[model samples]
Target: MSPLLAADEPSNLPDLEILRAEVGSAWSAYQDTKYTRATRLIPGILADAQRAVRSYEGDAQLQAKALLAMAYQGAAMVLTKIGEADLAWMAADRGLGAAQESGDRVVTGSLFRSVAHCLLSNGRLTAARDLVTDSAGYLEDGLPDASPTYVSVYGTLFLVGAVAAARLDDRATVRAFLAEADAAAQRLGQDANHMWTAFGPTNAAIHRISAAMELGDVQVAADQGPRVDSSTLPLERRVRHTLEVARAYSAQNRTDEALALVLDAEELAPEQVRYHFISRHLVTAWVRQQKGKPSHQLAGVAQRLRIVG
Candidate 1:
């Protein structure tokens, strides 16, 4: 944990604003790409914080802590989404540490929420539940009334809880969590619109469709999935949506249709080899195996998908 204050004394809030601006710039560079150049910006971000900590111009303690807390949360998310569990856990631990030092209830609540989410991604349901439960007081204490970040924290709580329940096969609990997530998603609406591709209606729709599928509500998935407007989706995200539809087709036992769509997705974005399309191939391969035609083209696709994974 780093110091929140500097040797110099604060004279005005303008310097605080500049620090915030610098932080945004750093984050933007980090988001545009993750290659070597993008990775190189991290030191500048940390150094900027160090400079702010030493520059006496505002509520340095709160400012420094807040910036660190945000950084930790953002880094954790990047780690989680790309299937990098080790780095995500480390970043989350750092976030928790920073939040504790900063003593910002909202930030603390957000940190715990993030930790709970990473646990959910790793399929550690019990751990996720405990952390979110522990975080409730901080969430309620801060009363995430008008803050978009606060609303997002609760959204993650509900969504991750639903995922946990799904893992445990707790249909009733899963339904409950989905309800809560839908409510939270509604609360997040336009208030929490960030340029990042992480949260928003698209995410909420994915969850809604996935939940509907697990619940054996295919019509719901069909109806809800189409509402995710392509106009609102970025190219990479649009590819994800295609995969979801393919999954929906599989759940409906439409193997041929699923294969056609999966082929289209693979064609549209070949770099997405690590995603769930491998499982799709395995499923179709099994279908062929059952049909006593393991040598078929469908079976070949399954083998290729496994190799891709």
Candidate 2:
């Protein structure tokens, strides 16, 4: 088990609202690729949240516990990006348990998204797909009269499921899930972040790029790349978009373009890019394919990231 999953009783607990806001701030730092800062802030927040849940009752306890789940999910996201899949899944599992206790469909659904991501990152594609599929089915009946929160969660569930299906080469399942996600996105009308799911037309479009890559349609991934405006997305997502574009370029043997895009991603989110398996593998492969020594910039990043000696 991850030490992050260990419970700690906080010495001093802040106001519940304050703790909640701080957790949000920590997550924002995480999105900005301040991984160490976010990790430093998480343990105390998790401890405080645990205390709050224990000390409160009814709605207050539920809300506090939901925040705890979100914090754990944030930790999971960071852990996975840093190549800590086992620890990441441990955090995700903790988040899932907390979400279940919270009994908020939106929170539960969002954590399901996090868990599916962990599974996907660990290459458990089938499990990832089935988890999202089962959860989507469970959440379906709640969608009609649901708030934007539930709508975003529902759409993201399908989005992750679509990606998993695409990776599994189940093109039919991919299309079906993407269609369902698109329907939800259509209902929402525009891009919006709710429950941190970031599900909307724009996000669905981003998924299309990744899905194309998963389906071995590298050209399609490259072509669809320009459609996503990075400036419109959060820093985390912008970095992800850039990295995916880099991957598509790499697949097409456009090494220069790929390196440039990856450098852009590194600039946007150094911590995320520096530790990501894709970044390491791409750099290593790109360098090995070169006829001579890598260019200075490529060599610099590779050395800094320890992708090559």
Candidate 3:
């Protein structure tokens, strides 16, 4: 057995509730861009979860396995953002397996969401879209009367699929998926972090901005930019939305605004923004667009983010 997953290793398995709480805390840290802390917390949680699933039975095992899946999802997300797609894929695959074992469809779909994201990060756009499309369809049944939680889960799936489609430049599929997700968001009537999916009208709108940017509709994205309420989202997502807006502004030759938005994202989540692909691209563009020497702050940001020498 791999040392990391060895059932006999010195283990400090928390109770199932504590395990769940820890995973939740890890997710919160992840959202706040405290990636160092979150990443450090994942391996031990994963170990305990694996042991629990192997050693326990009944609901306890199911719950433990579910928590393990969440841990894998979080780890995969961070790994992917850091450009470690192979490692991320392993975590995502493990997560999907654990989710299926738990018999929670929403949880399973959420894992699929992470898997699709990892695939996209690895440049497997077609695979990512196909996976998310199939997963979303798997959740389509009984939607009319589904609980708010289920709807949000499916909405999150649809949004992920939309992103994949957008990356592929498949405008038709992108719009279709976004519309479905937006409808789910409208039904919710407000923002919610249900099951940590963070699906709601505001989140759907944020996705729209991203989609617009992906489609190279700088004007449309800029027009919709002001409508997003950053306060309604978790810090990580808020930073992402801000960066997407920065991209739109960059595309429109609004260099000053784009630079400001990139700086804003850095201020909101320094670690996340510094490591993000969008931030890298924007910083490069911002530097190239400057007519003269850049500001000290901008130079420092670019140097620290390694986008400039």
Q: Write the per-residue lDDT of candidate 1 for residues 212-285, one digit (tens) a residue.
A: 66566777776677677644544445566666777777667676776676667666654443334334553554
Q: Candidate 1 overall Cα lDDT vs. reference?
A: 0.60
Give the distance in Å from residue 23's predicted Cα in candidate 2 to where it truly belongs.
Answer: 1.8
> Which scores higher on lDDT, 2 or 3?
2
Regions of model 1 farther than 4 Å from truth = 1-40, 43-58, 188-191, 194-202, 213-223, 230-240, 253-309
Question: How close to the true structure is residue 176 of candidate 3, measured as C-alpha lDDT?
Answer: 93
lDDT minimum window of 10 residues, candidate 1: 30-39
Q: CA lDDT of each candidate?
A: 0.60, 0.85, 0.84
Best by lDDT: 2
Q: If both were scored by TM-score, which would come out higher, candidate 1 or candidate 3?
A: 3
- Listed per candidate, the RMSD to the true structure in angstroms reads 5.9, 2.4, 2.1
Please state the error at residue 256 of candidate 2 in Å. 0.7
Candidate 3 residue lDDT tens string, 80-195: 77777899999999999999999888788889899989888888989988997888788888576888888888888878878889989999999899999989899888899887
Angstrom error at residue 73, model 1:
2.0
